[model samples]
Target: MRNVVLFSFILLFVLLIFCANRTTKNESSSLQSLYHHAKVTSHPGYEHIWPNIEFGWEIIVGTLIGVFGASFGSVGGVGGGGIFVPMLILIIGFDAKSATAISKCMVTGAAISTVFFNLKLRHPTLDIPMIDYDLVLLNQPVIILGISIGVVLSVVFADWMITVLLIIIFIVTSVKAFIKGLDTWKKETIVKEEFVKHLESTATSSEDVEYKYLPSCPDDEPQKKINQGTILSNIQWKKFGLLCFVWIAVLLLQIAKNYTATCSIKYWLLTLLQIPVTVGVSMYQAIGLYQGKKITVSKQDHGTHWPLHLLIVSLSCALLAGILGGLLGVGSGFVMGPLFIEFGIAPQVASATATLGMTFTASISVAQYFLLNRFPVPYALYLTIVATIAAYIGQKIIDRLVNIFQRASLIIFVLSFTILVSAIALGGVGISHMIEKIQRNEYMGFEDLCY
Candidate 1:
């Protein structure tokens, strides 16, 4: 089976190059005409879609995506689609739909490489119990369901549906961000005396403990205090309620807009995106464990009642979120990571679980996209091979600098988010000309231009 798969991929790669070249030759004139039209139409207004050379900048950008995805995935225990999809759309001139499709295709290589690297290193045990086995079984059915839905939608109304979905998602994300900012400001302004008093008492108790005592001094002398910081109470129920309400509102909006169909395709793509990101997250966790960082485990088990039910629910919700993220061109782990955290999973475990879950999501997505003909088999194969190889190299570099560069992943996430949001806002107004001109020199041929 492996040999067959490899041979099939090789044949596909050759076919993709041949087709791309043929298309370039035959369609160059038409493409040039479209470019001129794009220039004219885009002068006063911005276009959501732009054109560029597929094999030129796309390859370079795609490689960069693979590298970053591998590097961060090594550290974060999540796939790098959150980084890659946005980069592809904003930097590589792919629309969100095409970016999602290509990202799904590309992530396979990175994810596979990361997983193999982690296995080779014999990283620390997951420590989370039988969650993996449970997930493996539960996820397959949900994924199959999602793929069935996505394949139908992709064939029937992919382009139009994606455009409409993007618009709604943009508006919702903007509003959610603004609201979060406001809530943060509100929380900062409020002062809770009870919370403060609790913190003070906790601090006092922690500080009274001693780590060591001097032997030369008086034996009866008081030991020096060791200060362990206070633990704040869980967030207030009112605030939690408000947050839940906001989430529900967002969910309702999505449902009313019938965007669930978009998730069908996205869910499958998410499985592919999970590969490298999960390995990265796992590696980081293993390093933390090696350094004696405590790992948390949930006491709840998959018993016959609520515990089992909750596990199933959590896994299902995660699967759905992964799909949604893929459709949104952000990747599955970003959304899954936070959701897992919210469900009282330890942060590291949450990151790891999300990444693992995403692997399944991405695998299914890649297959669905290929089946739907959204990606040509040859191009997909070439991309997969290149990205996978690059991911292995990238992971080696990450392992060498793990201690120093783990935090860099968070910084990259923040910066990538900023760039994506900025691109969306600016692209909505057609400001690509400024970005393109500044990033690339004038008089460059179409083949040389960054989309």
Candidate 2:
């Protein structure tokens, strides 16, 4: 029944694409011209205040908040867009749309830094690189597909509706993460006590009591160990090639989308092409995992033990999380981080893997924003650099703390805290904005994408 339902969903999406293309020849040029006018005359986002703000002390204060947000978000494997967007809008004094673009710029920097660190690092117990490449291959494409859907809905849904949904989802996900963290902390305590007792009974050295699953490493680990050569060798090129192919395919499609007339045959054709690219690639990976031909190596010996249903559910979760991110204007990291924990992944590997995929999506966003000329180059560049440094430092500090305390649950706590803060901050911002829109007697109904 579930497989049938899932298949039907994909089929429906495909059918819609074909249906649009079938009317390609019937679409009149005048209709196309009207759409072109809409694209030129109106902004896709809700609000864009005047006065050309984003200067002065705003930059200094925004930079400070960006540093804190990047560090916390990076350490927790969330993209920190929740904090970045609000900071950009309120402190930096940018409009909503530009704030989102610059927010992605910050996310791109942080994700790249965190992913680079994870690439040359090993899993806590497994020999594989800390990132779960197979998981990325399976999850990312569908997440992108869902994001496209969410973007469409974002255009149509009123601000208040999205805000209410965001608050509910974030709060629920955060509570679940807190509970998971408590469970993990208790388990760690029991293990620590047992290890100490065993050492006393056997008169063993502390080093001999090191657990197989702990991320224990020499404190003197050299930076040179993660040089270009080591990083290249650590990567699984086959999986990476597939991931890159998906990224490039989608990127090219979006570039093509810009040249075509809005809502025209060419535009719809380009838009619909993404379905095959995203769903096709994700389906390929999902099937491979189900058939035991591939694995999420960070899962240790249990990688190949996944049932078909579990694979379907995971792909579905990725889609759902991606859609939520799109609707709420938050990063996928906020949703994906907690979801990965629930998938029973170790917090260390989960954070790394989620951020690895975020690197791809964030880069895509930055590229699109650049194409749209949405932000000033100097500001974006400066913020990006700040985020990169902050993320790198944040990851290092978190790794040190976790290892010192032997508590991976710290990452989960950070994830929960970040989500909770986002819920309160963003929810409040949206509610206030919604009230303002109401005061001005704005339309609160479905928006026309064509207009």
Candidate 3:
């Protein structure tokens, strides 16, 4: 029944794409003109809507691309935004800002949906914490700091800067994934009965089992609790208070900017009301943390003193990932996962924490992008829904096969190789585009690529 439902859902998506493509030639040029105008025209009352937006082959292809990217991403325990952004730029003819904005929205939606599933997941025979809230909160502050910086910088820079940075990020990540895949493949081998026993043990045992690809802390060691006297506990008030003030300030500025732009009174009013809703949620969490009700770190992990070096490295990586993620319109989950492993976190815990952090980063970045009117709002919601659903399906399939799949290394290798090839292709196109734009000494937008 589950398989049938999945197949039916996929078929519906395919049918829509096929029908949309079949009528591609019938897309009126006037509608195409409208799309181009809509992107650049800051007309106060004009909201880009259906019929005014170009709907044809590109969108269909883009949707399919998102599905494929998200499917592989979920299987590999990565976010799809990296692939989504590049493909949107190279194939769908979207500008860098637009691609990043839409990709961020998609990632945010997927992360939120996946988090929901992870939290609710229950096994009749197996008992475990599926979503590690403690680990997530531990990483949130630093990750949020990094993401905040990234979002500000993303909007501050020129589109070309983002494009160039994305090329570098893609190439580097591809190489890393390829190397990691080889290592993972070599370490995992299929032993049919052994695999079955392990799965059974996992279901029956309360003890943590360590797999080569997914390691756990020693079973003898008790899970650590946060030290009440730690700096994290003492400084929560300052931290949350500062964050609240900054976000509120930013919200006010956005409202002011909207008014100054002479946008419709409705636009500014809506922005004033809508922006606070998100900020309020963040502030609420911050308040909880400030009240010492949240555990942000473990005392045992720090011993008698703070692990300054660990803190520095983790935050630095997060900050760097944030910049890359914001510029590329991704959460950089693959990158963060390895960093978490290096920090000696369990694979399961790291995955959950990374999802939460990615969710926050993507949400904040997309919100900023939306304020700047960088997103294609009409298409964003639909595409995000599709990607989120696809991610959930892909995750479920991978979960069922996790214990049985012995050739994990081979799977990773193929996926990494494909990502590498795609990166190279995207890099080449980006470089060539940059060269042409530089030579012409002119600013060209996505409208130039309209068919």
Candidate 4:
């Protein structure tokens, strides 16, 4: 089955590459037409979508680059937009705005694809649920609240500011992943040593009628099991209510902004429609929680404490992640998943639930961009298709590799390396741009930083 999945992915990738090349050959005129239409018809705030024209190799490169980004991203349950945006800017020579727009589209597609993959692979008996719907529900309101605020804050933060922020986030996240991994590795080693000492002691002791092995601590459990009732019963109602209030407030603000600006009915309608679509999943999960549905905890989380502090920290991280991710056209999962693991959520739960949040957030971000007509239609379409496929395959590849290697240290090391490289690359770009701005004395719409 593994071989078959691998072969299928290869075949699909090759086929898509062929299609991408062929499609680009004939898409120049259509792309030009789309640009012209968007320029003439798009609202004032979104004029940045209509860029100068290009064709041929650029399209292929963009698609191939997306494949690489999505594949790398899937390993860590990220949407690959971090890699996508940087590559588009420095490597592909796209302006920051265009790269962000395209990256949002790419993240949207990749997230939805992975969500579908999770759904398709879910089995009540044979397989553990990759996505934690209840957890996703419990967390979605806060995440949505964050994304909403982040989208608003995005405008206040200029391109350079956004770049600077991303650089900081990348560096901090890298350090956290490194420290967290090292700490966990040390704890596991100690546990293993203790287990071995107990075994040796048992062998030497004459009082033992039957040999009994020392059980590892909960932190070192092989699999996690969540207490569904406890999780549902202990829904941080105050925080949850606050998040819900924020969600509603943001929605109303959007409506007011649209109405006062005298934007088209279409924009108003899209905003209204988004509420139900975005919140519907959470509502459904809430209903399930009330319905007394059976909660399936994984092997690792069987008896762990679901603390209020954990919820607080997770939601707080989501808030910042949403803001940075929205501005930079990346998924919050890049930061959120690691934060979850750091906060004592099992790795699988962290990855799965963070992915669920990403899907919704990406959907919301994509819709906002699409409604504004800020997306590059044809180019985004191509990148999205390739990214979607590559992300799924990338995740599978990581899972298989994990099973084969069985080394937590190696996984952490690789993740740390990836994050470190990302920080350097993004920081380098931001610093270079800042230098140019300072030299030119053109700090667009901001006071002098020297002051």
Best by TM-score: 2
Q: In lDDT terms, which candidate is top?
A: 2
Query: What is each predicted model's overall lDDT from 0 to 1?
Result: 0.43, 0.78, 0.55, 0.58
Residue 229, candidate 3: how far off, in angstroms?
32
Q: Per-residue lDDT of 308-394 in model 2, one digit per residue for the tens?
A: 778878888999977877777677777787888888889988899899888888788789778867676656776787788778778
Sorted by TM-score (best first), the order is 2, 4, 3, 1
Model 3 off-target regions past 4 Å?
1-4, 7-36, 39-56, 75-78, 121-128, 155-164, 181-306, 368-373, 406-422, 442-451
TM-score of each: 0.46, 0.86, 0.64, 0.68
Q: Which regions of candidate 4 are displaced past 4 Å?
A: 1-61, 117-128, 187-307, 408-414, 445-451
**Cα error, candidate 1, residue 60 (Å):** 3.0
Q: Point out the higher-scoring one by lDDT: 1 or 2.
A: 2
What pairs collide in candidate 3?
Answer: 185-409
Model 1 compared with the native: what TM-score? 0.46
lDDT (Cα, tens digit) per residue for candidate 3, span 280-322: 4444444454455543342225323334465455556765775
Error of 1 at 326 (Å): 6.5
User: Which ten-residue region of model 1 has the weakest summed lDDT?
Assistant: 223-232
Q: Tens-digit lDDT track for model 4 on 165-247?
A: 78777888878888877886776567557656876767565334321112122243232122112323434364345444545
Greater TM-score among 1 and 4 belongs to 4
lDDT of 4 at 168: 78
